[model samples]
Target: MPVSGTTKNTAYTIVASSLLAVCLAYIGWTWLMSSGNPVLTDVVLKLPLGENGFIYGVKDDRGGATVPFSYRYYVYRELTSNEQIASELKTAGPFLVTRDPAIKVDIQGSTINVSTNQEVYEYHSSTLFRHTNSNHYTPVTINLCKHSSDQPTK
Candidate 1:
């Protein structure tokens, strides 16, 4: 039994439409789940950690004229197995946010020290855990506007 040309065309159209709908739904879901809109700023710092990896900082432009800007930090490294380095690399973070415009990062052994205007935050390389089979790490967010004086009123 041979199928008609019109019938085959209909089937193809149905499959294509279903796939398009699924893709659109997934995109919408991803957009909805993300936090507030943040644009990557021009500020970036890099600290080399041997040949295997390095630590970096990227600031996000989240605040307007009334609110202070926020900065985020990250660490990146090449995956290794059996003492062999893999082409693929992994990243973890935006670990925390700071309001300082000029932040400094330094690496001492496996520990990364971040210096801000008010304080210094330290993160150990061993404690950073990227999701299995995924390059995303569990992010930590700290509140910088705890004091009423820092908050911007509407």
Candidate 2:
């Protein structure tokens, strides 16, 4: 015997409703799990340089000794302006100055990696302007700190 049109429609509706309910439950579970977890913010620095370029005096939040607050730092190469470079350099302070023999930077491809005595930081290159025809080098420094409210010392 063949199934009736009404019966087929009812079966289809049941399947669709069950799928929708499952999707809603999954979404709710994901939200609940994420809400309880801590969220971390990242700070990035971009430095533009040609092959064999060098950067010095790179430090981590822990006075260049250890990584702090689980923050991941990066330094890469990208297009930048003179004013912006100057501002970042000033903000980064004399540590970024190459005068320190302890601090040394080596450019590998379009990225430069900065490392402390204990940890090494990986740098990322800009996908949008990685291959630009400019020969200028710009150092971008990013600092990641815990929110004042979240910090226990504060």
Candidate 3:
């Protein structure tokens, strides 16, 4: 009554497969329960963000830009009007601009107002005063306008 090598190999394979399945199930269950939201899963896992190797550079064809392709770029932003862009550029040193309209933190200061179109200008507090956190990053609020989505409190 000797055990065959084929039988031993089959048993090993079965055990390995079962262990792998259990490990995968545990990981999946943990992720689903902790976040309770699949959308946040990508964020938690630090998924690959296809940001072009280089970002933030001024383009000549600027007409108030925003993210062109990827909406996954995670950063605070504000849109500047043509007039505001001109005025700010005078004082704002070497800052980069994507095709999509954007303002940098260095140039963006407190009490900013921009009007991209022929509409009334929107006043903004372009300072990182209120959203200031005593953490690794010093969150600066570039107030494109008081109407901005998350305008940092000044």
lDDT of 1 by residue, 1-154 (tens): 8999999999999999999999999999989986654555544555556545544455556466886666555555533341121112212345555665456555555555555664334333344534446776543222222223255778
Instruction: Assess each prediction's global lDDT (C-alpha) against the native.
Output: 0.52, 0.39, 0.32
Rank ordering of all candidates by lDDT, starting from the highest: 1, 2, 3
Residue 136 lDDT in model 1? Answer: 66
Model 3 scores what on Cα lDDT? 0.32
- Top-lDDT structure, candidate number: 1
Pairs that clash in candidate 1: none
| Clashing residue pair totals per candidate (backbone < 3 A) | 0, 1, 10
Superposed model 3: Cα runs more than 4 Å off: 36-154
Question: What 10-residue stretch in candidate 2 is worst by lDDT?
Answer: 92-101
Q: What's model 2's overall lDDT?
A: 0.39
Evaluation by lDDT, superior candidate among 1 and 2? 1
Q: How big is the positional error of residue 123 in model 2, measured in Å on the Cα after superposition?
A: 6.0
Where does candidate 2 stray beyond 4 Å?
A: 1-3, 35-71, 74-111, 114-123, 126-154
Summarize candidate 2's per-residue lDDT along 2-110 as a digit string, tens digits: 9999999999999999999999999999898653321222223334455422232332233234524323322323325534433343333232211122323445554
Q: lDDT, candidate 1, residue 105?
A: 57
